[model samples]
Target: MSARRPIPGLGAAPSTDLPVLLPFDRGKGRTPDIYLATRWLASLPPWTPLLILAVMLAWPLVAHAQGRYAYSDAFDALFRWMPFLVFEGFFFNILISFLAMAIGTVAGAALGLAQISLNPMLRRAAWFITQLFRNSPWLVLLFIVLLAFPFEIVIGGVIIPIPDWMKAVFGLSLPIMANISEVVRGAVQSVPTAQWEASESLAFTRRQTMWQIILPQCFKRMIPPWMNWYAILTMATPLCSLLGVEELITLSRQAMEGEDNHPELLVPFFGFALVIFFMYCYPIARATIWLERKYSVKL
Candidate 1:
């Protein structure tokens, strides 16, 4: 062969004996920047929530010292209403979260499986539904459900009243269902094509292969995201207060009103809500991180 010329500015050609590396090859074995940031966040001290609670608790006292309000008054009011807030208000919020999560998980899993159906029409329909709700704002979905659904259902001359809280649960479940569907689709698709081919070689039908082999693999992978969504749904439960659901935020506002709507009580009352929610969600977040690490697939 004739002598090969080097490309301009490159000076010399690389040796054929050396292995060629593609641009993406440089990224191999390196953790993603997003993963590092997530790790850093997960490493936060367990006492961080306690520190936040302390700060909130001390806020009323600071305001009192500044001559803005009475510390004892706010403390006494908060203490007196603690049982109501926790038992009735906060518990109601937890109940709504549980209901919404359960409904969402079941519906989302079905929708997700449908998205992977062999039938083109079923898959397309599932895709359309997933994208529609997944892209819709949660608050807007809540409002739509609130308006579109009737207050009661008449079943064979029986009037079954649908409570606002029930409506809130249904509304919240819609977007959650959409998201979990995507999670399921992604987890199922993540399985190696070899496994599917191996099942096919064994004369297994697609349904049998999926249910017996693929779905079982996806369960562990789906858990962390499922928990993360639960935390998100729990936080979003407060949005139902706008729809007149008697959840935590609604009851907190009612408690503040009962306490003469004092400006001083604002920090103490709302602060307690903040602290309790953090306490509930923080452990869940920690557990999700642990599970994610444990279940991460090694390439």
Candidate 2:
């Protein structure tokens, strides 16, 4: 075998697979000055991207300080409280997202199926719901849920209070449900008409065919778009902060305004929040791409 050649920025290229995030042809006969940084960035290991981002952000501050103050009281305060607050806040963010996704998935699937119903009234009703939620501003939904929803339910003399967190989840889920309804409808309709006829010839009733023959196939087609929507919905979870939900962004602000927190630490604190979201959502995006490639429909 011939000796292996190395790629610039990246080490020797593997025979089996391309380097993560880097094109195989990245460094072939490249000019020295131009695109140098782009090649280097592409070649970097996954974790290093955030570190590089932090350094670039701090470059302005470092130049402004001119080495006079290597650090600040704000940064110190942020570090002191971050461990306790950031994780707690992030936990609630994830919790709210999980709850909203569960609710949206069930409701959206039903609405999607309803849109294709034989009954004209049901189809029209589903369409109306999808359009109403899809067009309404999420902030307006949040406010409506907050103000209009009853605070408690009384059943047979016992009163159960509705938590603000659940309200937030319902608010966020409204748009997600609408979008997911569209996803389901598109996926179901994408199946060949031949499949429906085949099922009918085999004595499959419409409902039976839908559940047994149609929805099963729709799963693979729906997954990629479903994951994509999940990512979008997760990113939108921060909007819960507007309703006093105490999620990541809300806690970040609280940390910034705390008596011990330094105003100067604002950048680092906000930067940390940004990184947290990136870390959470990046894997989801990657998985979505992988699933799309794996389960892509031939048609």
Candidate 3:
């Protein structure tokens, strides 16, 4: 090779990767922002820990003082007390919500499948149920459930004696089931015709194509939405307290006495509400994002 002659414009372009690895991003693979922040953090190592400590220490007081903490307080309190309470009040709530979601999911999928089903009765029934629940208000449905009967009214008065707790369960279930039916319907419908076609090529029943191929993938897409709705349900638990159920919000208010009447006591009680909310949600939010990144093909 000839001695390298100076070549105009031959200088190498700057590489994005740096010599130093980031603490949080070292095992996290590549993220340019993370690396940049890491380098900044490494250059001033003391600030990172100090800042985190400052944030943790400051969270409660900021809420007490009313500064850049209104949003923070809601979450901070949630993480702090959510564990002891969320599951406690909603021990039954989760059960009922999950059951409703399951029933709605199955029913919606059946209808979606029914749109392609061989049986006319199955198809008609699915559509009818969907339309009926869609037009009805969940709160009204819940009220109707509460007053329905000693023996639960099954369409056309089938002989099913419903328990009180089960009646509450049914009441909560109605709207949730209705909404989730639509969610599941959309998710099932979103699966490509190609995927269904491939499954069919393999001699899969429409049900088999849905269960094995479509629903699993559809569920992943459904998670963030489900978590959101689930949070809404948690917030709405106080409404159930209207029926004299002793839930967390009920307890928090019981402690508050009144927001306008008692400021000092309200702070602690408000703190109580904050604690309950964050305990369940903040971690779940963090974990949900982590899960989405970890499991999501698109991420």
Candidate 4:
């Protein structure tokens, strides 16, 4: 213990007599630390977020089921009406999505082609229309169509009533149409100039060239984005519930309210609705990815 520890350019070595403590271990019957658990979770794969969300959602549901709300009569009622709900709202969602896709594709393709028309007037007109719809908020467009369109058409004393749900379909289709138009325009432009020259060399007129040569090639490019748009459109169809369309969410609400309007039933009813939407949308998303990979042009 004498004062003889001074060194010229080196520090004193750490004392070997002191005990060293390793990082905290969750063994020896000790409780696990929250920080370590969180760190481990954070180190998981990218898909863990979705898995965590599923777990978070399911945990409460499991707890509620095992706890005071164990009877789950609301779920029984929901199950009882499952077929009806599926046939009504779920069916309508699919129907509305397809209808919008069909109309939007046709109208959007027309607008896209027109945007690149030889005539300046047609090009300007198409641009104006596309910009109008594309810039407008979807909900605003839906309301406009819902309110502006006549409830019924009177022609020669024959009345043809337009259902509110049909109006919703029209509203949803507007945005889809504008988007698909852009997809068409971009896909068409993505084609190589050499293809255009080859078509011209084959005596193909501009219209003939677009339809016969360029468009066929554009289809491959268009499909992946089209499926993507379809998925989006399907998700957006829930907005129709606001318009009294009795779509999935609307019907779910009705079911929940009809079951004595119990607070305990809220999670289960909505969870079922979430499952329904997930089942429908998940496949489209997977298919979109697959198609994009499959149909992607080599060029």
lDDT of each: 0.86, 0.79, 0.56, 0.79
- For each candidate in turn, the TM-score is 0.85, 0.78, 0.53, 0.77
User: Candidate 4: which stretches are off by over 4 Å?
Assistant: 1-71, 297-299
Error of 3 at 165 (Å): 4.8
**lDDT (Cα, tens digit) per residue for candidate 3, span 209-299:** 8789988878887675455445544444445555555566555554344223333344444555554444554445454455545544653
Best by lDDT: 1
Give the alpha carbon lDDT tens digit for every residue of 1-299 in model 4: 57687553466654555687966776775943312322332344545446544753565557555435444465577778799789987998899889988888899999999988989999999989998997798899999999999999999999999999989989999998998888888899999989999989989999899999999988888887787778778878999999999888898888877776766667666666766776677666666766766776484
Clashing pairs in 3: 77-274, 77-275, 78-274, 78-277, 78-278, 78-279, 79-278, 79-279, 82-279
Model 1: weakest 10-residue lDDT segment is 32-41
Candidate 1 residue-wise lDDT, 7-111, digit = tens? 644756645655767467656867443233334445777777677768867775565564555777878999999999999999999999999999999999999
Error of 4 at 205 (Å): 1.2
Residue runs of model 1 more than 4 Å from their true location after superposition = 1-44, 60-69
Q: What TM-score would you give candidate 1 relative to the actual structure?
A: 0.85
- Candidate number achieving the greatest TM-score relative to the actual structure: 1
